[model samples]
Target: MKIDTVKGGAYALTCTEACTVQAIRADAAFITILEADTAGQYSFVAPGEAVEVSDENAMVTQVLKPAALGVTGRSGIQSGGDVVLRNLMAEAAAFSGIVNANGGIHVPLAAGAETDTASVNRAYAMGMAQLVLMHQTRTYWLTSSCTATNGVTINHAAPGCYCEVLLGANGGTSLTLPTTGTVSGGDYSKILGYSIPFRHNGGAAGTWIKVSMLIGAGGEWTESLDAGMDGYRFRPVSGSAPSIARLVEVTLYYHEGYKSRVRELIGVGKPPGYVVRTTESSLNYDSNTNPCSAAYRLVITQSEISYTSELGAVVWLVMGGASGDTVVKLADIRGWDTYHTSVSPTLYLDVQAGEYGGRVHLESPTILNGIGNNTYVRYGLEPYQRSWITAEAEVPYKEPEQPSAS
Candidate 1:
């Protein structure tokens, strides 16, 4: 007898007739008929008796992470006349051709002003411009001023005492006088007055120090100095140069060496469904009605398949992305919204899907006592699958006696 089997866990069998020549030719066909001691069933196994199942699906194997490259150094060279240092910083950040990729950078500068208000206002304006720039290019800059070099001394009972002034960096042309009475080495003293930059107290105690309107002029701007009482030698790093250099530093920071894929997918074929993890909130809207925007974000995570020995190929699939907007980013987003209304009044980006990885567009209106009232909406993505099956069971099987008891 011979049998054949197919690939699908099934087989075929064949048997020859008892009177066939092949049967007669068998070597010693049971030499003589032997009676069986017991009767037994003889069965033939068929290939169809067994079944096998296999699965073949695609999955992510590895992910190439993103990288970031930050600006290392920047400086504003040279100087211009009558310009606001703070404004220069803002302008530099705005005009710098640095790619930010939704990331931001900060630049520092020197502070100059006579009154606290002047300094504070300058800082505020610079900060505001940075914010605006972030909306457009997503970078920022900050300015810092040098600390006071010397303290002022007031002759305890005298109405006014001649104070020694030092020269600091674009000819800090003018300086203020101390409001507090001085006799000390480490106490804080306020710089008063305007129009004349002065170096509180520095240089050799008894050294001859005199101020003149001109480099060596002996008239008009002439003033004599007593010993520098700040316990430090005060002398211009150079003869007499102004320190008011109106310059703003510029820099940029952004992620690099990282690649991304965006894809817009639609349900297709028998059961079409797609999943997406957004990088950020897509919700945006008019600001007049509701001042606040929604606070959720989406980011995508991916894995790339690299094992080629058995599988032979690798593909990356986005598993998930960050969700929930951080409070800090949310505040910035709110400020951006306010800026839009005050300046342009139009919300910029809309929800859209990518093509390479995953994309989805969704709407979430602000809920207001079932009335829905917020200006912008934010949302997170949830994964979904199509072509899935679900099953349910009927009531449990029971004996008739159980029914009678019931």
Candidate 2:
């Protein structure tokens, strides 16, 4: 069954704590407000408060939707190994749709709750691998000249290894140049020695120096560590593979509190005659990226944050297509600007219609650094297979029909 088939009821459960309702459920084709009567005050269920529904096991799933209480989608790279539980959406929807035919939202009881990471690491390690590769590449400049050298034989080192230069007897040092060739010595061959390319590790003092002051030792016959003492920085070494640059940026689009402003500006209904790219051929409506007009599908789900006719908490936008609506789905979200005032959080969505050469605009309020800037925008690359989409909660919507009548 589709999500719309389920019945939903809105009732205020508590009067003291912002008069918010704790849960919502589907009772047959109708929705029932959980704990509405017991709380003694169920009139506070405002336009943007919490929403709860029923689950598959005939149990109640609290805050399963992004609009529910304590529900949050936290994104980050896993630091260590760990095991965690994530509710698979498609399966949950299918399972929940079977009996009730009404979908449910599962609220995470462990927001900010610490959990073990042993098993989670195994799976999340994929993301961490990218960071590790970046670090390693940056350290050696991604060149093949950073390997250790073998002291046994002239050619016994690895493909990218370096050879050392020995200090000769006549105050001269034996430098093993990167190339292999013969050297000729003339009369002043003592000063005009074979060219041996070498390098040093800028020692303990953190002073950056390739070669220490060349010392003149008349001529001594000795084969020891001092023979290669005077340090030199590592020379230019070639690698088997060529080097290349890797610079990647991943941007995530989320609600920046613009949803709250929509309520104050224009609450729901027909979305203020917003224009969507349609084609000249027919009028079915485009949701995915439409080559004909550059129109695309974007997912937008709504829920109530703290609410009342005058004030309320901000709403969140979910990734993916909106329920039963596709106009906003296909629009491209672009442009971003951060504002200073609580009323001016940077939010600007530039919906471009390339195929048709047109554009639409979207903006929202955002909060930053503990202040309510209340605006934000979506930017960069368009939709990828598994990306995210967040809708502003303030954008108004048609209030779902009440269960008692429908």
Candidate 3:
């Protein structure tokens, strides 16, 4: 079964929700919708609105697929975990293929609800695919790092698969692999560091960092949790394995349908065009760094506030990387309105993408009282595997609009 492991993966499911017909919760072949026999208001209910099932059972749909498959070749739904659900040209022609991938989109999607055989409202519903990923952990001891004569495959390649390998800290050594690949968004370092920091935080939601500014500590069980579908072969970055005991886990996320056709999603990488990154950031009442490229927008899934100081905060953006940058104040983050610590709120900048890369910064209060420590801003990194095969829900595609600077 395809299960979204990240937050925001949960939409609302109300207790008193209605369905024209029964939708089997186990099937991803179709969608669940709220119907109205009177007004013909077949409008799409947001994953936001709640819906109830049975007398209970988490009124939410675990996964979904378009109702109909297009006649396009090699363009159908598939799953990350299930090989039984696949579509071939024959299947698409016969309309007998299974739609069950972790994260993927159509080849040439049909327009409107009628032609859109999938009836997916894709433009409004999906994103970089909300990837179907696989994760595994194992302990190994390496006395030496071998370059040649021994090429070991740690995790087998899956469809639409890019590979990433990491070294463990308990062994306290870094190893290099010849088979590892880099993501188009950035590099392995950014991918691992961005989310892991805030995720492991011990705060309420492990998002916000309070009163403490302790960074770069020693004996810190640091594991370069760098794993992605960067390439087909999953191997070490180089032969630089540590000479100690280590426990390592390699996770793979891919679109089941695009396994053989794995290509770049944004610039030049794999499918599911989205990259999310975070840092142990703090604003002296005025500063934040967006770990994303110009082609992407920054959203904080989890966050932390100042423990000693309660003040106003603003989520601002700087077009291009300059000190005297244009300050676009997106929204004001009121701590009083939200929980003081581990504050997780939705903050985004309403702006257009230009040829230049922009930065999302958090500005702290210039008018607040004395505080012992700087305001810590820890962003929770949610699992984001999305694809933009259509304009569905306004997903960006190819080059991300390198428009003239506005």
On lDDT, the leading prediction is: 3
Better of 1 and 2 by lDDT: 2
**lDDT (Cα atoms) of all candidates against the true structure:** 0.19, 0.21, 0.22
Error of 3 at 15 (Å): 51
Better of 1 and 2 by TM-score: 2
Model 3 bad stretches (over 4 Å): 1-87, 90-100, 110-299, 303-406
Off by over 4 Å in 2: 1-67, 70-162, 165-406
Q: Give the TM-score of candidate 2.
A: 0.16
TM-score of 1: 0.12
Per residue, candidate 2 scores C-alpha lDDT tens digits across 1-406 of 1122122322322222222223333332333333322212222122223343222112222222333332212221123322232432342333323343235444443434455553465446566555433321100011122121222122223232233222211222121222211123122212110111122211111111111111112111111121222111211122211111000111111121111111111121232211111111121223342221221212211111111222222212223222332223221211111111112111111111112222121111111111122211121111222212333232311222222100
Question: Each model's TM-score, in the order given?
Answer: 0.12, 0.16, 0.17
For residues 1-406, could you state the per-residue lDDT of candidate 1 as single tens digits?
2222222221111112111111111342322111111221111112232212111111111122211112111121112312122222222333335454343345343466567767787889889656433322110111021112233122222223222223332111211122222222121111110011112121111211111111111111112122221111122222232221100100000112111122211111233122111111222122221101121222111111111112111111112114221221110000011111111010111111112211111111111010022111111111221111122122211111111100
In TM-score terms, which candidate is top? 3
